[model samples]
Target: MARDYNFWVYIVTNEHESVLYVGMTNDLARRISEHRAGEIPGFTADYRCTKLIYYEHCTDVQDAIAREKQLKKWSRSKKVALIASLNPRWKDLAPEILGE
Candidate 1:
């Protein structure tokens, strides 16, 4: 049997650490790849925010969307706090996501 793929709400940050990008995706790897490759043109691509700083998984898409929306509305400090909770060093979580 195939394993179920969970949806995720994730945040990407730039090198200067001032900007943040919040988004949701079923395949975290593919989405991150798109961001890194600059395949999707927008704030993230323009700002070069390809570092996956934080993420939260959900079994339901609606929950993921709600969480993404909530995060998007948060202040930069609040977002940083959330990211720091799981990633104190604010490390790139992409490798973790890939189980590497």
Candidate 2:
């Protein structure tokens, strides 16, 4: 049987907003929590990019993955513009996803 699932393309930044990380995940809230907790020992953890500044929803997993790859290839200024357009202040949006 085929099941419809939700995928999310999300961006997280460090405390100084000097770095950005783009990723796709099936569970946005859980992923963000992992980032916040520094559970991953890679880029997000190394750079402390735990603030969820932006996200988008896609019903198709392929689309979400493609979007994440595309964003990763984007220039920093372009990525910052994209985030600023939706989140001008670059605020941490984890609470919304966390249902807090």
Candidate 3:
């Protein structure tokens, strides 16, 4: 059986925590690849924020969008706390997501 495409709200950050990028996507891997490859010329690529520090899954795209907007409106410290809660060390979570 084919897998269903779930929506996701994710946060990426630079190594020094100087930059943060919040986004929503249906394909996390491809979106992360684009960021890594600098395919999208914007804040993330400019700051080299490719680390997948945090992400939340949603069954509905609208819900994901709402969450993304909510996160974007939060303070930097709150965002950091959210990330740290699930990823205290701020480690790259891509490997775990991909089961590598």
The numbered model that scores best in TM-score is 2
lDDT of 3 by residue, 7-99 (tens): 989998877878889999999988887887778898988899878899999988789999999999999999989998999999998777766
Off-target runs (Cα >4 Å) in candidate 2 are 1-3
RMSD of every candidate to native, in Å, equals 2.3, 1.3, 2.4
Selected candidate, larger lDDT, 1 vs 2? 2
Measured against the true structure, the TM-scores of the candidates, in listed sequence, are 0.90, 0.94, 0.90
Candidate 1 lDDT over 30-58, as tens digits, reads 99888888898989888998899998889
TM-score of 1: 0.90
C-alpha lDDT (0 to 100) for residue 54 of candidate 1: 91
Global Cα lDDT for candidate 2: 0.93
- Which residue segments of model 1 deviate by more than 4 Å? 1-5
Q: How far is candidate 3 from the true structure (C-alpha RMSD, Å)?
A: 2.4
99 Cα displacement, candidate 2 (Å): 1.4
Order the candidates by lDDT, highest first. Answer: 2, 1, 3
